[model samples]
Target: MTDAPAPKHYAPRWNSDPRPDPPAVGGERETLSAVLDWHRATFELKCAGLPPDRLSEKAVPPSALSLHGLARHLAGVERWWFRIQFADEDVPMLYYSDEDPDQDFDRLDGDVDEAFAVWRAECDRSRQITTAAASLDETGVRKRTGEPISLRRIMVDMIAEYARHNGHADLLRERIDGSIGV
Candidate 1:
């Protein structure tokens, strides 16, 4: 008999709200993009079902971390790394300034829905930029240092950034509702 396909492993508990699973085998670009998207979805799922007021709640005392703030910070990061740094686009930085740099996490003003919308838009733009590149080897200048950086490096760095934030999101979500899952 022909060999059977391998069985799926490690199913996520929250099947009702599914997160994208990175391909088991794929090109580097596809793998990186899928992983990043998975992290993005994970972050969104963590914030799901919470009202705007709750979304902005610190949840954990003595810490300014919240789903709303994380959305804002992630959106700014997406724009900063992909649009501004990688594509060299002329766009104003979001939720940040020289004088008030931590505004993304510190000041939780505006509508929570609006923050998520902005974040989704930035993710779309980042994906477009990545797709347009001929290869991961394509280089972009570092605005601060004037050094070249590759698309691969940016994707890897972004993955790390999302991983760290997702961990924070897990804790914030648990403290907020006592719900937890992968």
Candidate 2:
């Protein structure tokens, strides 16, 4: 089969996505995959075009939920689920050390561009793994647990992850600026 066209990267922002829309009535795999992609894009939109310091700010008092933290966590989440969990690729943690378990959310010291780049690479690799899988039922072993996981479950979990985190992102963005909705 011929290769799919190279994806174009347009820096995303609230209500300004260059990505394609998902089908309203596609097959199970198509629909699920498309929804996953949409949620991922939503996460990006919520964090786009913010200043580094703004991104790093923990908007909610006593809750370490910054847009920067969300980006870092989501990057690790993508790598955890797709690379370590789904593709079974040997990889190291994106953040978080034994002493700093909340590094992704707590220690926001890295450059924003570097964090975004890591997240983008993970997203691209995730799409590749999903595309190459034979079906949603395709199984991969979980790294830490040594248990089996299905692509279907991973997709659903990822959607939930984005949904939950995007909520935090929305609040963070609103706090950063008065803007809301995407």
TM-score of 1: 0.92
Summarize candidate 2's per-residue lDDT along 68-168 as a digit string, tens digits.
Answer: 88889999999999898889898997987788889999888869889988999999999999999999999998877899999999999998999898888
- For model 1, state the Cα shift of residue 139 in Å: 1.1
Residue range 22-141, candidate 1, lDDT tens digits = 999999999999999998998889889999998899988898889999999999999999999999999999999999999999999899999999999999999999999999999999
Which pairs of residues collide in model 2? none
Best by lDDT: 1
Position 84, candidate 1: lDDT: 96
Query: Candidate 1: worst 10 consecutive residues by lDDT?
Result: 11-20
Q: Candidates' TM-scores?
A: 0.92, 0.87
Lowest lDDT block of 10, candidate 2:
10-19
Candidates' C-alpha lDDT: 0.93, 0.86
Clashes of 2: 0
